[model samples]
Target: MPRSHWLDPLARRVLQATGQLPPARSSATSNNALARPEPALPSNWFLDVNRGSQQQWRELPGCTDDMADLLVRLQRGGVQFAAADDLFRLLDLPTDLAQLWAPHLVFNWYGDAPLQPVRSCIDVNNASSEELTSLAWPDQRIHGLLRERRLRGFRDLADLQERLCLPASSVEALIGRVSFGQRRAGPSLPPRG
Candidate 1:
């Protein structure tokens, strides 16, 4: 079928993927990179909600360091934003501030929350040895993770991978399921009276 046969965007994308629909003809806008408004971006221009780096999140105007950290932290932990509403609600952004970011945001994932894979992100920096062991990783990886963290905190995926020398497959598996943050410190029990 021709691309125009599918009126809906989702149907078109799905059909295109299945090779049932011909791709739409290219247009003058194919070379959009030259006129991209954001100059700091390395390659691709859009900031995708599903899978984008922390640096991409920071490119948005009015995106604070804390906000970027929270966004990346939450996303890395398996939280997916369905719409601008999700971002506004989770981040507690004022309407005006959300308005500023609304246009720049792109949602790559399609469909409801339950329909997607349900993987809660594990904070490698703070998860208990038990929690880390419960996952598919072997005992050696778990021990290595805990031992390395004893020396210092993991910074990001790259930092963790470099520090631990994780195999490519392990790092790939860890992408959305792992995050790094300051270890939650607990107060010691008060001295007995």
Candidate 2:
């Protein structure tokens, strides 16, 4: 009753050579249609189609029937590499696959600015002593300036420097790094005690 029992060594070899011994089945049909010889894997396999055959020889197993149907649909639809990355991400594919397809992912792939340096905006009015200390300046002078600003409100940058008795050149140098802005005006200062 078993199909293999009917096959002898020579007969099996002959059948295999002629592509006749294995009776055509759905799996075989699907495999035959999808599988093609891939000579070598490329550096980034998903991106370099020419390096590896366009054929997807192995199917992702343990997929539900619905998932299998979806994969077939995706194959027929012909996914762009970028789109494929998103699809795999949405489906929560393995990390290896995600990394493999990351180069192809369109979300943040390429743009005019290849690299952009980070710049931070410092709030002069609300920055803590620790935050102010992080700047390239004397920590004592910064602390003194912050104290002066807290006691007597600064109308402008010049007023702030004057209140703290700091040098005009120092203030000028720090202008680009520092920013002055009005605070949100908390609770009307509790009617000044």
Candidate 3:
């Protein structure tokens, strides 16, 4: 049977209003309209990667206590995830679990939280190794960045990608979060106890 016949007119209207149904599709040579594949509605639990607590993560489908703890650690370390795939990649989460939680994951995605802004960024040239870890930037990458910054230093965003061998997509995702300032390079000193 055609999709239009699947639901009565009133049901279609209500679904459309709530965005629970996709827009109807029309056949090429006929006035007949069929419903497109149903779009997945937004999940009730949209967890923000930047601000979600361990408890909140544990509440997500398929998320275990260890996984939630890891997530919270990443957030505290200053990792600014661009998307769900990034999170999955960083943590090496199982494919099935990632899929189960994909619809509910978001990076810096706004939702119920306190009335304070969250900043997701790090200064490549000035940030220490520990600070760089916040974005889950590889340890080798951090070492390379620090060594290079001390030698010649980054002049602009392009310099960051070129010096660090970062991809264009990574640089683009950091547009607002990055600062290309002229802070002088200094000795790589250990964090004082």
- Write down the lDDT of every candidate, Cα atoms only: 0.65, 0.47, 0.63
lDDT tens readout by residue for model 1, 1-193: 6565455988888898885665554554545644653333344456888676877787776677877886675555555565666466545678877866777778876444323222567888888877786557888878888778877788776567677776544554554566677966642122459
Please estimate how well model 2 matches the true structure, expressed as its whole-model Cα lDDT.
0.47
Q: In terms of TM-score, which candidate is stronger, 1 or 2? A: 1
TM-score of every candidate: 0.40, 0.31, 0.36
RMSD of each: 17.2, 21.4, 15.6
Q: Tell me the tens digit of each residue's lDDT in model 3 across 120-140.
A: 756767876777777656778
Worst 10 residues of 2 by lDDT: 49-58
> Which model scores highest in lDDT?
1
Best by TM-score: 1
In model 1, what is the error at residue 44, expressed in angstroms?
12
**How would you encode candidate 2's per-residue C-alpha lDDT over 1-193 as one tens digit per residue?**
7566555777877887785554345876668766863223353434331122223322222234454444343333332222343345334568765555445333332323222212354666766666776666786777676656666545544455556665534543443355566753432122435
- In Å, residue 129's CA in model 3 sits off its true spot by 16
